[model samples]
Structures are given as C-alpha cells and as structure tokens.
Target: MTKTWLIYALGGGWGHITRALSLGRIAAKHSKVRILTNSPYAHYLNAEGCLVQWIPDSAGFSATCQQVRHIILNAECDRLIIDTFPRGLGGELADILPQLQHIPRILIHRDINPRYIAAKNLRSFVAENFDAVIVPGEGKDLPFCDLPNVHHTAPWLIRSDVDLPERTLTRSHILKVNETIKTILVCCAGQAEELPLFAEIALKLHQEFPKCAVRILAADCPPNCQDLWISHHPGIECLAVADVVVGGAGYNTVYECAALRVPLVAIALKRLYDRQDKRAQAYCYWVQDIQSAIDTVKMLVDRIEPQKKPLPSYINGAVQAVHHIMSYKF
Candidate 1:
C-alpha cells in the first residue's frame, strides 16, 4: 500500500508552500503527498502532482477538524507536517495541532531558530502540541537541546523542473520612478504593516530618480500608496528585467535572488520567533533597517548591487526538500 502525507503551510504561504513542495516532490516518488496552504499560489502546487488543499487564513479549529476529517477519510495519511503554528492573526488555528497528536504529526520550523526565549508563552504553548519538531536552517542559534523528540535538521534547498522562460526586458518594465537610477523589485513577504512603508520608500526612491520604477512582487498590498512610479505583481518573471531587487532577508528571498543573479536591497523583518536577526546575518551584505523609513528606502535604492558570488545553479525549493524527505528514515 502506498504511504500518504499531509503538509500544512499557512503563514506566509509562499515560503511555506515553497518549503513544503520540496518535501512533497520527494515524497511523491514513493508515497502519496498532499500540500495545504492559504495562498493564491495553490494553483502552482496542484500541477506538480500533489493534491492541493486550500486552507483559509486563521481558520478556526472546527473548520480545520473538518479538513482533517476529509483527509483521514479519503487519503489516510501516515504523517501530517505543519510548517508553523500560532501565526499572527492565525493564533486560533493552533487548536488543530493538539487535536492531531493522536496521529503521527510533526511541526516543521523554518524560522532560523524557534522564537522561544523572547516569546515564552507562545513557545510553551507550541511545545505541548506535536509529537516532534523539526528545525530547518543552521542550528547554531537554537537554545533547547534537552527538549524531547526535537530534531535538528538543515533547511531544504529547492530545485525546480520548470525552465524559466526567456524574455527581454521591456522598456516599460524598467521605467525610472524615484530618483534612483535602477529598476528595483520589492520582494517582501506581503505583510500589511510593511507594505505602506515599502510603498513610501518606493515613492521616495522615485523622487530621487524620477526616471526609475519600483516594482512590488507581493500579495495583499494596498493601492494608491505612491502615485509616482510603483507597480505590484505576484510573480518574479519581471525580475528578469529589473536592475535591483528590494526584499526582506528571508531564506527564500536570499536564495532566489542569488539564483537569479539579481542585485539586492534587503530589509530584515522581525518575526514571531526571533529568526530575522540570524537570517539578516547570513545575508548581511544587502541588509536594511526595517524601522527607519527614509533609511530603508535609501538602503534599497542607493546601495543595491549585484551579488559578489556566481549565480546559483538552482532555485527549486520543491526538489531539494523532497530529496531530503525521501532520505529521512522516519
């Protein structure tokens, strides 16, 4: 009989989906795998051979329990992996994990380190839920080694099968907006608080370089922020035409930018589990101050430059994660 698995990725579903797809791709070779997320990127996942389940953001426990019931009845997965729990405005969703304890379940944490020290209450709550925890990324910063069943694992790299399309940089795609002399791609996580700040920075950057444009490739951004030269999209196809890319210092962005060989201006956002600092440290060359409005914009526009290293050979998170999962014994 074929084994089955369910991967839940709700918070910042783009990253979560990317990470989970890596595992699913690998798992699909031997086991039936399904991916669950609340992002619009769900369509991209379905085509990859994994069944896609769309979970709404901050869905209550009852709703999720119904989802679990469907999975158990139809797929009968042997393993259930959750990417993160108690996400912002998604805290109420944590109730579903504890309910899954009777089954084989694992929590996959990609936050460089779990935010336990600073987020005591939140950490304690999560500690009680799952049967095991998997920490991805360099384990240098994690503090709790004595915790039972906690496993230290490296972050899975992605490898895509889809070849990127060849396209020329359209002159309209590289217009000068702010006084900055370059086309900058804002690669943020699409959080609401940072959207306005990014838009303001883009407006300011346009003022500095009226001939340039600031393009945002994120989800859920507000309109009419900077009437100047700002545009938004949900894919990275345009990055092919950009001169510089502005984004937070997440692992996905770092590797993606390096893989694309695009110049970067990165801001480090503080996350629930204090993982931002370490992520910033890993990509320090392009780090920006998330708190300062003017400085943030300037850091992206004035200093953004090409990476010193050779472009990465691959950016397929799905392929890398899957390869590692298949090698995992249990």
Candidate 2:
C-alpha cells in the first residue's frame, strides 16, 4: 500500500501555509499527501488538491484532545510532518503523543533557537516523541542543548514560481519622491502593532531627507493610514520596485528578501508567543530597530544600492526534504 503523508501546520501565518503548499506540490506527485490547518488556509490548500483537514478551534486542552484523537484515529496516515508543535503555543498536543505512538513523525523548525526559553520548556517535555527534528540552516544561533536530535537540512521550500512582474517594469515607471531622498519599502503580516511608530519614523526620515519616499505595505492597515499602506498584491509588487525593504524578520519575508537580493531592516516586536530577534541577527546587516518608518527611510537613503552578495533560494529545498522523508524506513 502507498504511504500516506500528513502534515499538520499548527503555526498561524502565511509561512506555514506556504510550507504546506510547497510540500504538497512536491510530495503529491509520488504519494498521498494531506495538509491540515485552520480555515481559510484549509480552504486554500484544499483548492490546491491536497486532502485538507481543518483543526477546529478549541478553548482548552479537552477540546484539542478530542480533535487530535478524531483525526489521528480516522486518518490512515503512515507518516506525520508537524511544523513547530510545542512552539506554536499549542502545547496540549505534547501530552497526547503517547496515544499516537504508532506513527513515525518529523518536526520542521525554522527558528534560530529550537530551545528558545519560551518554547524550550514546552518542547523539552514533548520532543522525545518525535522521530526527527529538521533544521533548515547551519544551526548558528540555536541553543546547543538539542544538537543530537536536530538535522541540519536544506534551505526552506517555497513555491516553484511566484508570479513576479517583469523585472524591467520596475525600472521603467520608477517614482522618485525627491532628488535626494531615496525610496524604501516596508511590509509585514497583519498583526503589526508598531505601524504607528514606524509611520512616525518615516515622517522623521522624510523631514531629514527632503527627497525620500517611504512606501508602507501590509494586508490590513487602519483606514487612517491608507496614504502609505500598499495592500497585499500591490505591496508584493512593490518589492521589485524597492531599493531597500524593512519589516519583521518573518521566515517568508526574510527568504523573499534574500531571493530578491533586497537589503532588510528586520524589526524585533515582542508578542506573548513570538519574537524574531534571534532569526534577524543571524543574517548579516539585518538590524532590529531600523523598521521604524523614519529610521528605515533614512537607512534607505544612506544605502540605496543593493548589497554585494547574492540571495538564497529553496528551488531544490523541496526535493531535498522529500528525499530525506522518503529515505526514512518505518
């Protein structure tokens, strides 16, 4: 019988969805591949042909346990790929691992620290149940305690061809704010609460450099801030037009910047469950505070020229990951 591969994406973000889609694109060609996540993401993944499972919202451990049991017992999965289990603020799954010990499992992690103090306490209690932990980078900044279980894997897997407008179009209609002030681009996932501060920074930078124009890009911007906000698709289009890009140090954003060779100003925003500091500092020239709109705009004016080094990509990353998963014997 053909093996059934089920990927549970617990983390909430476009990055997790992107990973699931990329893996499904690669693995579906050879075996049965399924993706599970919450709605909207599930709908999108289902539309893409992967067998989709939507994890229902559960207020507490009892609700989560019911959902997990239902899926694991019902699905005829031979292998399970989980992206950041204990790290995604859903630690209840850790307690129920013994119940699903019959299946081989793999955990995908892209953070700089696997044992980040916040996620460490939870992961420490649950990691033994996993068969492998795949780390995409060289493990430069991650904590050293979990070295034995970590697999230094390839770069992240991304959609094979993101539809980008012709590169020449970017240079043709270039809009310059002023003769001296350079252009800068800013973008982030929807939860960015520091946008107001960033806008303030942008105003300051514009005052400092009379010729600069800073473009703020995001999915959902407060109505009052529409003047600078470039919504979704248009915002992504701006990436090709930008001289430098500033935003949070998210896995997808960082990878996209590297792939496009744009200089980055990665922000360090603190949340109850997430922080991008370690991921930002690992890359050269990636600064945290430069995400302030004014500071970012000034930084762009100072360094409009592209960095000398080429960027990274995951064109082969999917293939490599599949090979690893396939090589494992149950």
Candidate 3:
C-alpha cells in the first residue's frame, strides 16, 4: 500500500510552511505528502503531489483544536512530520500522539528558547513520541536535552532550479540608487504590520549608504511604500541582485542567505516562542541592534569592493533531510 506522510506545520509566519514545503516537495516524490498549515501565506502555495490543508480562523481555541484533530483522524497518514513545535502550536497533537504510536513520528527541530523547554515539558513530550528529531543547519543554538534519537542535516532551503530567474534578466531588474552601484536588500514575509518596521530599516540604510540602492522585498506591499518597496518578486530572485540582505533572524532568511553566499545582517525580533538572537549568533552574525546592523552591512558592502570573506563549506541541508526521511524504515 502507498503510505501517506502528513506534515504538521502549524505556525503563524511564512517560515514554518516554507520549511515544511521544502521537505514535502521532496517527500511527495516518494510517497503521498500532506501539509497541515495555518499560515496565511499557504493560501495558494503549490507543491506537486502534496496536499496543503490551511486552517482558517475558527470560533476560539477549542474550535481550532477540534478542527486540527478532525483533519488528522481523517488523513489516515502513515507518518507524521512535525515542524518546530513538538506538540503542535497549542498542544493539539498531544491527544493524537498516543493513537498514532503504531507509525513513524519525526520532528524537524529548529532553534527555541530554553524557557520553552521547561514551560512546555518538551523534553519529556518529544522523548516519548518522536522517533527521530532532525535538526537542520543554523540549528546549533537549539537545546536538545541529550535526546538519543536526535539527528542533524544541512539547512532546509526553499529555492530550487525552477524558482530561479534567468541569469541574463537578473541584472536588468536592479535599479541603481546612486553611483556606488551596490544593492542592500531588506526582506520579510508578506505581513502587512511587519512592513513598516522593515520599511523604516530600509530608509535608515539609505541614509547611511547613499550609493547603495536600498530595496524592501515583501510579498504584499502597500501602494504608498514608494519605489523602494518591491512586491510580487520572489525573495530568492531579489537575493540574486543583493550585495547585502538585512532582515529579521528567521529560519528561511538566515540559511537561504548563507546558502546563496549573500551577506546577511540579521536583527533579532521578539518572537513568543523563537529566540532569534541565538539563531543569529550561531551563524556568527553580530548585529544585535539596528546600529550594529548598519555597521555590519556597511563593512560587508565595503569589503566586497576589495575582497569578499570566505564562507563556510556549503552543505545542502534540504537534500540531506530528504534522504533521511525517504530512507528511514521500520
């Protein structure tokens, strides 16, 4: 019988579904892959051979939980791939864990604040349920609590050859802000409220570096954002033109920048469960404040003129993750 692998990617930001899709895209080639996500960005996200179930706003907490549980029961999936949060965003998976013990249960473990370890009793929850915990690259800062089944892989990046733009056209899209001819790309997910924060950062960067063409890449842009705010372009395409990328220290932004050899100035955002500060530090990023970000980006941009810093060895974490998941057996 063909096995169905259901991935639980219940998170608010684009980061969760993006990472989940990276694995699902590959896993779907081997078996049926179903992604359960709540991200607003998941509306029309297409992954071949994978079914994405987007949970909408329900009445309240109980309603959301009931909806999630109903989906799992109906899915009849042979495997469970939980992203980040071990027991779902609101512990919805806890009730179904015992019922699903007959099949494989895995986790794509990323960075988390240590406080959550105690607050959620994640150590015990994971030890009892998860057969394997796959830690992608940039996850060095995560506290694994000595779980015997923990494994490591490269970073889970979303860009594939199909997503890349034509090399000839890439250079044409970048407009020069001034004579310096450098590009500083500030990026974030398509969150309307997050737009102002990144927009302000882009404005400040333009003030500091007048020569660089500063641009903001958000999936959804307000018309008033002026020429600087670019919408509808894939974030990966913008990375091709950027000399430096400044953004919140999220999983996709950090590793994708690293994978493409783009200089990143990651500023930590206050996330309820995620600790961006630690993720940035794990990658040797030193931008703790906006001023520090400015300084670091300036240094990298300037250095690129004379010589570029040698990056660490490039490893395809997403490919490695696909291998582990597809090769695993009972």
Candidate with top lDDT is 3
Global CA lDDT of candidate 2, please?
A: 0.58
| Every candidate's lDDT | 0.56, 0.58, 0.75
TM-score of each: 0.66, 0.73, 0.87
Q: Kindly list the per-residue Cα lDDT of model 3 for residues 184-296, writing each as its tens digit.
A: 88887634577777877788887898877788877666344577777533466566557788988888887777777777888777898887777777663657677888888
Tell me how far the alpha carbon of residue 155 in candidate 3 is from the true structure, in angstroms, after superposition: 1.0
lDDT string, candidate 1, 1-330, tens digits: 888888866654467776676667667778888877766555544335577777665566667656645554454677877775533224544555566555566666555344454554655655676566666654544543445756664455444324433333233443333232366566655455677776666556556656556555555444554334333322444454466766776666665555566655666677754365566566534445544533545555565643233233554544544454445545
- What local lDDT score does residue 124 receive in model 3, on the 0 to 100 scale? 87
User: Best TM-score goes to which candidate?
Assistant: 3
Ranking by lDDT: 3, 2, 1
On a 0 to 1 TM-score scale, where does candidate 2 land against the true structure? 0.73
As for lDDT, the candidate ahead, 1 or 3, is 3
Q: Show where candidate 1 strays beyond 4 Å.
A: 29-31, 39-47, 61-75, 85-107, 112-135, 143-162, 167-181, 225-241, 258-263, 285-311, 314-320
Clashes of 2: 6
After TM-score superposition, the amount by which residue 83's alpha carbon in candidate 2 deviates from its true location, in angstroms, is 0.9
Q: RMSD of each candidate?
A: 5.7, 4.9, 3.3
